[model samples]
Target chain A: MSTKSRKRMLPWFPGSGAFVDADTAVAAPDTLARVTEDQRLTNDGEVTVASPDTLARDTSEREFATEQWQEVIDRKLVDWGRNPQQLEYEELIPPTRFAIQSAAAIAMLCRDHALAPPMRVVPDGDGGIILERWKGSLSTSIEVARDGTVEVVVVEDCRVVSRQVLSLE
Target chain B: MTSGDGSEPIDKDEIVLRRIPATFEWYNPGLGKPIAWVAFKPNENDRSGISVWRRKYRPPCEVAARNAKPGRRYYVLGLRVALLRAIGITVEPSPLEGGPGHANLVNLSSDAYRRDKDGITQLAKIIAERLTICVDGPFGPFDIDARQE
Candidate 1:
C-alpha cells in the first residue's frame, strides 16, 4: 500500500476557553458622563477638578486589599490539599473555597471600612467584585459545579452587572 | 466398485480466503529480559502474495510491566504486503528498498518512527488500531524484521 494510505488522528489540547471580564468603574450616570468627557480632553490647558491622587488611591487601595485577601485564600486552599497553581490554571475552584474567600474578603473590607453586618459580595466576570452593604438590596447568585467550576452573577434593578467565572482554590 | 458405468464430475471456480494463525517474539539477551510476544493471523486474500511479515501493537506497559504480567493480549492485524511476504510468496518490491533482497517492508517516515528501531514499530501501531487496543510501551531498540523460511 502507498505511504499515504495509513490512518491518522488529530492531536488534543487541554482547557476549553471559558472566562469572564469584570468592569471596575462605579457607573453613576452623571459621574460617568463627566469622566467620559474628561477622557476626551486633548491638552486644552483647562484645569480639571479630577485629582490624580484620588484615582490612584481608589485603584491602588482596592488592588492592594484584594492581594492581601488572596494571600489568605491561598493559605486556606493549600491547607485543603489543593494546589492553588493548578486550580488557577485549570480554572476549577471548589465552592467551599469560593464562599470562604468571598465571605472573608467582604468581612475584611467591612472591618477596614468600619461597616455594619450583612455586606453583599458581587463578583463581576471581568475580575472585579462588588461589595454592597444593604439588606435585600443586592441580588447576586453564585453557582458552583461539583467539578469546582464557579459562576457568579449579579442582578440589580433587572440589569446584570457582573457575571463571571472565578477560581477560588 | 462393482458399477461399470462411468460418471463425469462438474468443476466450479470459487474464490477462497485463508486465515493463518502466527505468532512473533522479540528476545533481548543483554538485559536478561523476558521475551515480548504478539499473536496475529495472516489473511489469505492479500493481493501482494507475501507472507511472514512483522506487525506492530502498543503494549500496555505501564499497567502490565509494573504488575510483571506475561502473555498480554494486544490487538493487531496483518498487512496485505506483510502477509504475502510471510507466506513465502515473492512479489515485486516497492520503489523503497531497505529490506534484505526484494522484500519491501513498509517504510514509515523518520518523524513517525522517531523511537522505532525499524518499520515494524509502525506496523505494530497499525495492527493495534485495527484491533482497537491501547498499545504504548518500550518494545526494544533493535530493528524487527520478518523472516521467512
Candidate 2:
C-alpha cells in the first residue's frame, strides 16, 4: 500500500498530516529574526547563535543566553546615554517580533518615499546590518528614520560610529 | 682678643661662625662618601667653615677654603639645623670653613623658599639666628644679602 493509504489504514491513528498550523509556523520566522537581532546587539559585534530553535529545549540555557545578549545591548545603550527601559520587551511582543515590525515600518516608509525596497540582511556580529539606501551613497539612521519610515525610533540623529565586516563563528 | 684656650680672636675672615644643628653631612673624597659635618660662622663678613666629624679610623682635618663651597654648604647646614631644632635638638656653630656644613647653611638660607619641604618659619628663624638677619616674621625683610646668580 502507498504511504498515505498505509497511514490511513491504521485504525487508532489520526490521519497522516500532523503539523503546526500556518499562523503558528508563520509567526516563528519573525520570532527567530528578532531573537537573532537581539543576539547581535548583545554580543558587541560577536554573532552567537545561528537560527532559533523551534523545539522544546532546556529553558535554562535559553534564559541564560537571552540574559547575556540583553546585558550586552543594555551596556551599549547605556554607554550611548540612551535609556534601556524604553527598550523593554512587551508581554505581547516576542523579542523577534520587533524585527518584523521594524522591517515593515521601514518598508512602509520606503513605499511612501517611492524608494526601492532596502536590502536588509542579518550581519554576523553584534553590529547591525547596514540598510543602504540609494545604492550605498546615502544611508538611513540605524535606529531612527527621518523620512517617517518607523515610529519605533531607537536612535535620534543617528551617526555612524564605526563600520566593519564581522566574522561569523 | 683671645679665648682662655689661647685661640686667637676669630678674625673678620679667619673664624667662621654659622649657627647650625648638631648633625649634617659633608662630601669626603678620602672615604668616597658624605661624612657628617657641622658649621661655624663666627663673624659677619667671615666665610663660614664646616667641620667634618670624621670616623675614628679616618684622619681629622679642616677642609681648605679652595675645596669648600661655603654658600652651598651653609644652606644645607641651616636646613639640617632647622629640621633638628624642630624636633628640639640643639645645634652648635662650627669653627672650620669650606666643609659641607658651611655650604649647607648658605645654600639653604639663600633659597630655602624654593626647596621642597623646607619649612619657611624654621628657615627664617635659622637664618635670623645664624646669619644675624633681622627677621620680623616667617616672611619679612632681612639683612642677609645672598642672591641667586
Candidate 3:
C-alpha cells in the first residue's frame, strides 16, 4: 500500500500521518523557505524527516529570526532586562513586560527611520523607559512612560538636535 | 560620561563600563553577536541598574558601564569584559569597581552566559573565598571587607 494509504488505514490513531518513514524525502523548496514565503508548511509524508528545513528548525528556532534589527529586538531586547520586584530592598525595578515591548517598539521605529537603535534601554527613575543611542559625543534617546507617552531626544555629534514628546496613543 | 559640546569634535574616547549584575544573563540575547559598542549617559536615577537594560541594546557592542556611585552592587559577564577589552573598549579592571570591598577585586567576568549555573556558582565561590562580606549594618560599600573566609 502507498504511504498515504497506509497512513489512512491507521484511523485508530488520529493524526498518525505525522509519522513519516525514514526514507521519505521531498525535493521541493525547503520547509523553512516555504514557512517564510507562506506562513504554513505541510509534511506530505514525501519530505524526509531530516530535510534541510527540518534541520534548520531543529537547530535554531526561526520564530523571531527575521532581519538583523527585528531579530535583535525580539530575541535579545525582550529577555535581557529581567528584574524581579524587590519590596524588601526597594532597589529592584524589574523590567516590566510592557516596558520591554515599548523599548523594542521604539527600536523598531529607529530602524524604520534608518537610524541606529539605542545602545541600551534603561528604566527612568519615575517608572518610565529610555532608549539611548550614543556614538562618540552624540546621544539620541527615546523615553517611554508606562502610560505609552514618549519623548525623543536627538544629539548628533554632540549638538542637541531636538527633543520632542511623541504620542503613540 | 563627558557630555561633549558640538564644536569640540565629539570626543569618541571615553571608556564606558557595564557593571554586570552577579546573576544577570546578558549572554542570552538571540541575534547576531555584537560587533561594536556605543556610549550613553548612565541614568543617575536608576538605583538598581536593572532599567539600564530595560530592553537591552539591539546592536552588538559592550554597552555596559559603571554608575558614578561607588560600591553599588552590579553583575558583569567576565567573557564580555575580556572581549570588550580585547577589542580595545577599556573595560574597568574590576567588575564592581569603586563599589564595595573585595567583590570589586574578584574576577567575575566570563565569556559564557549567566544561565550556566555551574559557571556562576564557580565564580561566586571564587568571589566568596577571597572576600568576607559584612552585612551587619545597612548594606553598602562600607559593609564588605577583604578578610576572606
- Estimate the TM-score of every prediction: 0.21, 0.15, 0.32
Error of 3 at B127 (Å): 28
lDDT string, candidate 3, B80-122, tens digits: 3333233332222222422211111122222221233233323
Candidate 3 has a TM-score of 0.32
Query: Model 1 Cα displacement at B126 (Å)?
Result: 63
Best by DockQ: 3
lDDT of 3 at B138: 17
Q: Write model 2 residue lDDT over A1-169, tens digit each, in one string.
A: 1111111110100110111112221122332343333332121222244344422232344444445434433433232224323222111111133333343443333332222222222210111112322222222222222121221111111222222221111
Alpha carbon lDDT of each predicted model: 0.28, 0.25, 0.33
TM-score on B-chain, cand. 1: 0.20
Q: Order candidates by lDDT, high to low.
A: 3, 1, 2
Candidate 2 achieves a global lDDT of 0.25
Sum up the clashes in candidate 1. Answer: 21
Candidate 1 CA-lDDT value: 0.28
- The true-versus-predicted C-alpha distance at residue B70 of model 2, in Å, is 89
The CA-based lDDT of model 3 is what? Answer: 0.33
**Interface RMSD for each candidate model?**
27.8, 37.6, 14.8
Total clashes for model 3: 23
Candidate 3: C-alpha RMSD to true structure equals 18.8
Segments of candidate 3 deviating more than 4 angstroms = A1-66, A80-90, A109-115, A122-126, A156-161, B1-149
Error of 1 at A12 (Å): 32
